[model samples]
Target: MTYDRCLATLKAISGREAASGYSQRALKQVFGTSKVTFPLSYDRQEFFSKSVEYSKGISISGVQEKLSLRLDRASNELVVTRNNGEYILKPSPEAFPNAAENEHAAMLASQKIGIETALCTLVPFKTGELAYLTRRFDRLESGDKRPQEDLLQIGGLPPKAKYDVSYEKAGELVDQATGGKRAVKLDLFRRVLFAYAIGNNDLHTKNLSLQRAVESSSRFYDKLTPNYDVLFVQAFDNTKEGQFMACDLLTDPETGEEEFTEPYQEYGFYTGYDFLELGRRYGLPERAVIRAIRNQVDSQGDMIELIQSSYMPEEMKREAEVIVVGRCRAISTGIDR
Candidate 1:
């Protein structure tokens, strides 16, 4: 949707309803600022477009229609990521509407919530004539400034397994993929929260990544990066609740389960996260969890704006709210029944 239409819709919604109790950060996401417009000189569908021959691993087939793979530049993302071999090309007038915009919002939301995620910034792509592209977390071993552009989701444990089916399995996979050096505490929780907050139900085992950063500028740091690939696919399909929740096998922490076992089973999702126990393990506070929830609620407008600008129509927008806010709220204060 155009900025004018987005604003008008929000105005209409705001006038019709009142703040339904959201977090401050969530509110900012609903209408904080303009999406950073990326410059692009390359059009993927152009008559003279060039298709580079990189390994096609585990990306959603046919998604490149709206995105092109290319190297982009920006100072902000420089320090955050180390050696991404390739950067995903995101062109303007993109094949799909508002995907790039929604992604940008997801990353910004991750940062706002104190998650240890990759540094992200919108930059021009396609020779700075077409549109903007979001970079990846993988580093290039080939030694060219433009990383090889291997899709991060393709790098999960055991090479090409899904994470959504079982998180404990994912934990073990993380150890295997990274050769036993998993940043369990920081990496896992952030990913869990990010998936919930951004509505990224597609976070299958393949979607989450484990980077082996170069120790001597050659040996990669064998651990997970903050988080990436943050867009809600459930929005595209009518499945807006972001399915794939289950009673995953709860692992045996004391026994030190094998690193590759699919420990958790899929139990149904609880409306909100009760971090009281989880927070204690990480030395994090339950208040922090509450604060995060509040931020998501408060900045819901910005989140709404991002969605409104994307392929999501106004009707779907209301549906998204029913699921997103409703589910989030259900978990937050339901200390008892």
Candidate 2:
């Protein structure tokens, strides 16, 4: 369906049309209808006051102000009760313009590239302000919390040490999680390549997680969770000079040794060769990496279409298109060599 800002006509978090405007059927299948609307009548000053007050005991961590909510289907509104919340709501940050819209677009782009990203949608607050809503993957339908550990936790590092490792090292952790399954490694490789292509430089350890069924008896069978907190930070930031990646993807070229180093940035921007080398290091077939890049090149049109249909402002949409298209071209050219 065509993209629109109206909740009823807009795309649902499931990436499907809510033809009847978040009808009972749609809400039941996606977000429960009991979702409560925010206290929209409050002014900016009052909004934050209530937000902070409601978020007092809720403990989700991040730079943005977010709160957990339970949908009161009977009222067709979202409530901030202390009950187990099935969804997380992120309002627009006062410091960042269009942050919510940017996140929604980025998450949608990730899904278009065959990555399983967190399902999210842009919903209007009662005050008519739009906010981003994402379903919690760690929460089960039966109201039980799934066992989940971020890469930082899985690697035995604290939150403060999130940047102490490289994306390559994170792949090693994934290998350990999947018991050296080549498919999982390949999936990690593709995710890294996709992150680089889309300028998602903030993919630190905390953003990646391993999750499994709480009911499952096997403790060693966790799988990589859906990608979350993805955004095109490079497109919005002017500096673009802070290492370009959360962790090193390759070794330092200055050492003249064949081994890769921690926090490597020998090459300015990640090229196709970098991805190929990373795949090779992870035991992925070279042809498969090349094929994936080519597939990305072929899918450029679809990406652009999704961007055009996104809720992002026109200027931001254009900026994202340029960055994404240029990166895809660079990958294709690098691979040709």
Candidate 3:
């Protein structure tokens, strides 16, 4: 089925059937794609371990292929409606350390240096906050039923939902998501690099998506989703203890607007690990990884100085630098990968 049909179906299901053709069309573009095939690769074990090793600085959702919705956000993808039309809420969060702003900064920087990103809108939330939300590329695969969860169900074993999908399966998943007719983008290479340099470790299947479709019944094709959730570890003070690393995530549940800085956790992290692993998943060269590490070290001062001036105090900024820079040096040269 064509993506237009899929859009029609999803909109109907969401009770947005009467939401105006133009609005629905806008939504359709978010999930549309050219149909084509391009070879891809993966390595889950490497990604998982590296994700943790790389995340040694903060709690992360572990890499996901897509940000599929559950029963909770069952109705709408971006905004939530309730009260039987009495009230509606959007997915915007009113919190510290803007995730969208960092994403925009990072994307602009990455693209300036020639990186590929589907690109996204800098949407403002009701809370006066902004967060980058990428569109889902995978279609409603519950037999093309257009269920919201279908987005999450991709990348797993066949005839099964929620099957284990790994990094190695990334290529295959990309094929299906992109309709086997999309170009193999080199910008993704830069995305992996820039994400590391900026510490946007939230790279997962959901965060990364494809836009595939067959317009006018011509053919199928796809491309990776735009960069979203590009928040940086340095965006906040990060001074809270036990907030960094994969171990901390695997161990407990956390709540609070704490600093992503140090005392770090028992794992010893100053910032976040996404910086290191973003390169690892793509099989980045050791030279590249080392270069990224060194670059961050060199640039940390400027970054910290900037942060101190804006969102944090001098002591908080200094602590972040010590934890992040000192430990990064230790790990960068010694990492086995």
Candidate 4:
């Protein structure tokens, strides 16, 4: 019931020997706790049943099963309920083995590359299963809920149409949200490029959101929320198309031909040109986008080390490394042209 070594930093997760663990102050600020273990029974069946029942009202949209939890500081435990919860916990899916580990590694990789990603960690269930834990960013220190909208809603699209828009539309949403701030636009471009480089083909509208400041007077003012739900889908899903991307970098012109055309066929596999064009559409310089891509490419070693330290199986670790390295090379080669 005690961890002598942290899975992340190789220190203690708790106990009197927890000095070198994830910084207590930083953990408290980000996750509301320095304690790594969730002080609750890890009954997978009970948890899933409760989450299914709760989804009727407090549904977190996605194919995966997730539960919102509030940390009872007095007892230092997590309860399966939506009562002002500070974290979202996702168990490994039955269909996708090692999903929690995959997501945890992906989030860590994103963070290492300087992306403002949602804080995440892997926790062990009593059943010896690992779950992905992410701190909720939509809540304030005073326990006030901040107003937030996803790209789908911001673009005036219904939830059912989440996958219908191109990635450029998200840039438009960011532009409107930040009132044409060049820095935010450039950052958005970097995020998009990062998604491509990491083989995350699931950057759908729901995955990107805008959060309004708790004290902002204007209703329209907001900023991009920390990146969430990023994963190397192609690495895990064998059935996934090799050239697939979640959203188009640009809208393809209508040829008006009745022949069958593969999605994003003209651009093929989201090359550097696609990302550069996306940046140009948002008024970001091509050199800036190239720099962003190169910066991430340079961090491949750090990314691999973090991946190795993750809880994913060794086979999966090898697969993920290959996917990441291959993508980085492809992006770098494309950009050099």
On TM-score, the candidate that comes out on top is: 4
Rank ordering of all candidates by lDDT, starting from the highest: 4, 2, 1, 3
Q: Tell me the whole-model lDDT of each prediction, alpha carbons only.
A: 0.43, 0.69, 0.37, 0.71
Model 1: residues with Cα > 4 Å off, grouped in runs: 1-39, 47-49, 52-58, 61-86, 90-98, 119-132, 140-160, 172-184, 212-223, 241-268, 273-319, 335-337
Misplaced by over 4 Å in model 3 are: 1-92, 97-100, 118-151, 156-172, 175-189, 213-221, 238-337
By TM-score, how accurate is candidate 2? 0.83
Clash statistics: count for each candidate: 75, 15, 41, 1
Model with the higher lDDT, candidate 2 or 4: 4
Q: How many backbone clashes does candidate 4 have?
A: 1
Query: What lDDT is obtained when candidate 4 is compared to the true structure?
Result: 0.71
Candidate 3 lDDT by residue in tens digits, 1-337: 1111111112222233232211345344443422211110122233234434433222123222212221123333232212122111112223334433444444444433444543433333333233343433233334242222222445543422222333223444555554543243233434443444444444444444544442334233345554544545443444133223211111111532222323244445433343344334445554665565555455555544443332223554455445545544544443334
Sorting all predicted structures by TM-score, with the top scorer first, yields 4, 2, 1, 3
lDDT of 1 by residue, 1-337 (tens): 1122222122223321222222223323432323222233334454124333333322332354223243323321211112343345443233345454445545555655556555444433434232223444453446433212122343423443343235554555554454544344345645665566556666655455555544334333355665666655454444454353321323447764422222111223443333333334444455665555555556666665655553345665565455566545544543332
For residues 1-337, could you state the per-residue lDDT of candidate 2 as single tens digits? 3223334223443333332234445345456442534333334455466668777432112457776776776775666555588778777675556777778888878888898887777666555566777888887777877788888888888888886667777788888876787776777777777777777778788888887657677665457788888887666644245455677775434562234422234554566767777887777788888888888777788878777777778877787788789888766755774
Residue 33, model 2, lDDT: 49
**What 10-residue stretch in candidate 1 is worst by lDDT?**
1-10
Candidate number achieving the greatest lDDT relative to the actual structure:
4
Candidate 2 regions off by >4 Å?
Answer: 1-29, 32-47, 56-62, 237-242, 251-267
Query: Which parts of model 4 have CA positions greater than 4 angstroms off?
Result: 1-5, 8-30, 35-39, 56-61, 253-268
